[model samples]
Target: MNAENEDFVRRRQLQVQRELEDATRDEVVVEPETGRLPVCIESALPSKCIVSFDAHESEVNALCWSPSGRLLASGGGDRKVKLWTVLRGQHQCMGQYLGSNRAINSVTFDDEENLVLAADNDMASRVWGVSDFRLKRS
Candidate 1:
């Protein structure tokens, strides 16, 4: 190869090596104190896992997890609230209830775990029997 081509290749190789070294290097800073022995610490660990669930067609306004942590309920701008089940580490939409004409703002499960209370911007609140998802009238 020509000398000019060889020089270009060597420069590119050096640049790549420098980048790799910088990427793998640990960046840390320590402050000195007068009364105590110095201590060394590594940087905080990064998050290892993330789970994202997209069950609502519109903006999600609220969410509640079941007492067992095996299920989730989500209320959204679509004026609906949905219940989801976590099976084998994946979230599955189990049921949906259209409770109001306007956006549902909040949701919570009752003490017995058999009732769900939902409030919406429609100036109404609803209580639903969790077993059959039937509306409970006051």
Candidate 2:
């Protein structure tokens, strides 16, 4: 490789190394009174019950915990939305919605925990009933 190519490769390697080190470091310093809260690391394992759903063939793009913290909603690049229940360090897929023709990007639950909103690359936003998993139109 040329000098410029070697330099570029070295810089890229350094960046990758830094990212990997950061990913493995657990540098949580919680000082509640200081108002400086620590951010949760995505790769860190869940404390109690953890559930992973495989309904999506593509990457999971968004995830949200339910109001009661018992359920989790996951949207992905597979154009599907899935609901999971956490129990004893495992996640159980409770339901799925294949409403969008494109990848689902985001998901959120209403404060009452009765409704869920999902946004997708198809330029569509949908609301669904949590209890019956029925689509709600506005």
Candidate 3:
């Protein structure tokens, strides 16, 4: 690649690394009574929206919270699965998992949290590596 192109890619990589670092540094503060999440008095559960973000281009169809609740996986009508890092009620888009040809209908994280699996409108299911966002199976 040309020097300028390489420089641009390098800068982008650094930016992503910094974002990841910031997300990881922030801790999720859980209330003792609510277990691992905060509670809403009106609902008597953790149903409150502490924060929100533009998660997808189209309507979100499915959402799955990681075992630790630190990460969230969302599949949308836009044919994409996006990962989010949630810390202390704040959220940031971490990465996107691509490969679905149709809108995703459901999503879940593997028990080990190593893979993200989604079912799409195409009548197909796909699995992607959590860390690398590589398609593992379809």
Candidate 4:
């Protein structure tokens, strides 16, 4: 064989040998700490449930906490967006915003917290006034 051909064969053989070694090597398994998350975010998250309540008639699809942390908005498969007031680890249903004919998929509050918006499977977006729970736009 030519010198170039011989050199190529030698390099190919070395590559195959390295591949075989890597394929047969034992992999080390690292165990994660039980009931713990990464340090960077663990402190920001609540460690346990504070309270629970029936937020919707059907499965809840979306949830958003108001900027003040006092109110929570939830969208559900029942085609409703409901708001809750949180105080002393207890929650009360403030009211519900209705309009969408299909299941709601997302809910959020505007930056000013004056309006709550929801997107639904009906291919529409709706906004409601936080003060009145009346539909503002859709």
Give all candidates' CA lDDT scores: 0.78, 0.82, 0.89, 0.87
- Candidate 1 on 1-138: residue-level lDDT in tens? 699998998999999877767754766555466445435454343455546877778999989987777668889998888988877667788788765788889988876678778899978998887778788842
Clashes of 4: 0
The per-candidate count of clashes, in order, stands at 0, 1, 0, 0
Report the Cα lDDT for candidate 4.
0.87
Clashing pairs in 2: 51-91
Residue 61's lDDT within candidate 2 is 90
TM-score between candidate 4 and the true structure? 0.67
lDDT of 4 by residue, 48-77 (tens): 998888888898999999998889999999
Give the alpha carbon lDDT tens digit for every residue of 4-123 in model 2: 998998999999877877776756678879987666634542356344446578889999999999888999998888898877777688898767778888999999998989998878
The TM-score of candidate 2 is 0.63
Q: Order the candidates by TM-score, highest first.
A: 4, 3, 2, 1
Model 3 clash pairs are none
TM-score against truth, every candidate: 0.61, 0.63, 0.66, 0.67
Cα deviation of 129, candidate 2, in Å? 0.8
Candidate achieving the largest TM-score? 4
TM-score of candidate 3 to 2 decimals: 0.66
Per-residue error (Å), model 2, residue 59: 1.0
